[model samples]
Target: MAVTSVIASEASLFLTPQSIIFDEKSRSQAVHVVNRGNRTGVFAIRWIDHTMTEEGRLFTWKEPDKSPWSLQPYVRYSPRRVTLRPGESQLVRIALKKPYDQVPIGEYFSHLNVVMLNKNVEESIRQQEEGSEEAEAGVFRVVARTGISIPVLWRHTRDQPAAEVEISQWNSSQQTLSLQVKRLGQVSTRGFLHVIYQQNGKEKRLLDPHPLVIYPNIDGRKVNLSLANRALAGGKLYVYYSADKEHWDKPLGFASIQL
Candidate 1:
């Protein structure tokens, strides 16, 4: 006889009103989790607050609970355990009650996590005795797990005018190398650009410069580095940028050239 199994559908969770805009007033919003799967699934919902501190450390907060999930805080249900039938869904109401009026202007981010308990594992555990062979099977059992990422942003009024940076041309005359950066949306007052080049399994910094404040929406500045001295004839070049010099975001641009 063929065995029947339960499978969770590919689902997603996101904020409604997409992005939140608050100017010193209380706000309320709803976060929805949709069940796109063919089978009903149970979800444990919670909120995670990731904040950047003044000392450059990251502080995390789990909503409705003082201790964080990572720290093993008491687990309480925000919407309780939710059961979604096939093609069914649920909504979680989140209110920015107090501190919304006092929050500083910037981006505040949070994500929703939907989890499915492994019924198969639970059944196997129940079938096995303390010293039975079936109990040993528990060690080899595999469980299915999936997660979705949601980003939330809260912005206040800007104190300074925006600045933009653009990279018109990035190339290595002697070797094959190119790097480019274009500011998207409103630019900040200051930023840094960095490039990392690797050749023959060795890595080296190509161009590290501190450019002046760039005006908004203007043409990008150009930086060209010739690899004649470094013998960077052909290899991989990774380029990235950031507001602070020490911390760089993932390399948005990559190029592989052969000399």
Candidate 2:
């Protein structure tokens, strides 16, 4: 075999679409994972039970959520173990096992953890490769491989409407923008965040649509965005939060920075 240095880790894994949302009537859908690096990419897939902390961080636990919409038990995905050569891709199909009519209308959620395979083995391989080079040049050192993970989410809805959102508090200092989001209702909101500035009828967008999710059962989800100093320079900065861009164009909440 040809050796071109495996190094610490390979940038071989790529995930498309980023997230998944399944309606009550929908049965199954697919996600694509591609390998873009020179070496082979191996991965393992499993569902994790997690909840959003009051601080807006993810806390994963072995005990699943008791809600009817829990994605861990109902949604089944295939090809849990994936191995792909360079430039190759695989399809991971997901389907719901429970009957939609029987379940209550609410948002149940879980995460699909796509983890890179074999951390210890990869370290051994990298160490051996490094040692071989050191033997030729008479120098020795140890380097290890790094793991990569992509977060996938699944949601189920039953005639439940979209939730309302508001920015109860927002302020910026130096380069940091902080927000306290108030999410109303049992349904969670998943979408991208947009930061725009307008002055003299001209608009400047500091940040485009970036994925964000604020779950339920808390005072609210707190979040912060780091911006360049020029993002809010001499302009009216507007923070717009919205989902369903493909279906709706209006923002769910609008806020401006003061003090």
Candidate 3:
């Protein structure tokens, strides 16, 4: 598995509105990528397709086979290469191209990947004099580059999917919780989830608000979390979800399971 390093908005830079949606009449939208680092930041922007699987994992592709959910061919964004000084921002405009009549009837998804280049290392290398001790040591200095990705989707139809969840596996010995979240209906289900634990008249809350998205290509996601407490013989976990747009943080329904 690959490890990811997350950067906060003020220190590292970020994209405003991590996700985007579109109305039927809108043709284009723009996203801003800001640089909060001390040095000039270089970014290489590109569009990629992601397919959610039945097991709830996302698979990305540069060019995928034609399907109801592919978003690569129709998406366009610029300026693909950006050079910004510290605390500067740039606009990346995304537009959808057509043969609209040929687009499939379900939701299509794509991602705008804003990848950061190792500018500090490049700067260091440029300043090095020939055959110097400092230059020889500079070759071993590792550069850790980081960036952000945003999901953009266009739904061609009006069918909104229903989402459901169940505890598929719970390992009390390991203090792990596993849930199988399923999505129904024609469109994807994007929501927020809150997890709580209860035992012996006491309650404990876990997770500091999370985003939930179940796409059309994936039927369900199997999520695993660890429970730390060991004293209770009987414990139950309660979970709730709500749609993202107008119903953010409000639970439409909740479910519980005994451990």
Best by lDDT: 3
Instruction: Report the lDDT tens digits of candidate 3 across residue range 126-209.
Output: 566345566566655566767788888877777655677777777878877777777766667777766777888987766655
Candidate 1: where are CA atoms >4 Å away? 1-26, 49-77, 118-140, 158-163, 172-259
Which one is best on TM-score? Answer: 3
lDDT of each: 0.46, 0.64, 0.71
Instruction: Supply candidate 2's per-residue lDDT for 58.
Output: 78
Q: What is the lDDT, from 0 to 100, of the residue 80 in candidate 3? A: 90
Candidates 2 and 3 compared: the better one by lDDT is 3
Q: Whose TM-score is higher: candidate 1's or candidate 2's?
A: 2
Model 1 agreement with the true structure over 62-121: per-residue lDDT tens digits = 452442212112112258457666566777755554534454444333444556643233
Model 1 / residue 46 / CA error / Å: 2.6
Ranking by TM-score: 3, 2, 1
Can you give the TM-score per candidate against the true fold?
A: 0.44, 0.67, 0.71
Give residue 78's lDDT in candidate 2 (0 to 100).
93
Residue pairs clashing in model 3 are none
lDDT of 2 by residue, 83-168 (tens): 77667888999887867667655666766767766434444567687776656888865544343444444444533334344555
Can you tell me which runs of candidate 2 are displaced by over 4 Å? Answer: 1-11, 65-69, 119-155, 158-178, 195-211, 217-219, 224-237, 244-249, 256-259
> Alpha-carbon error at 66 in model 1, in Å?
13
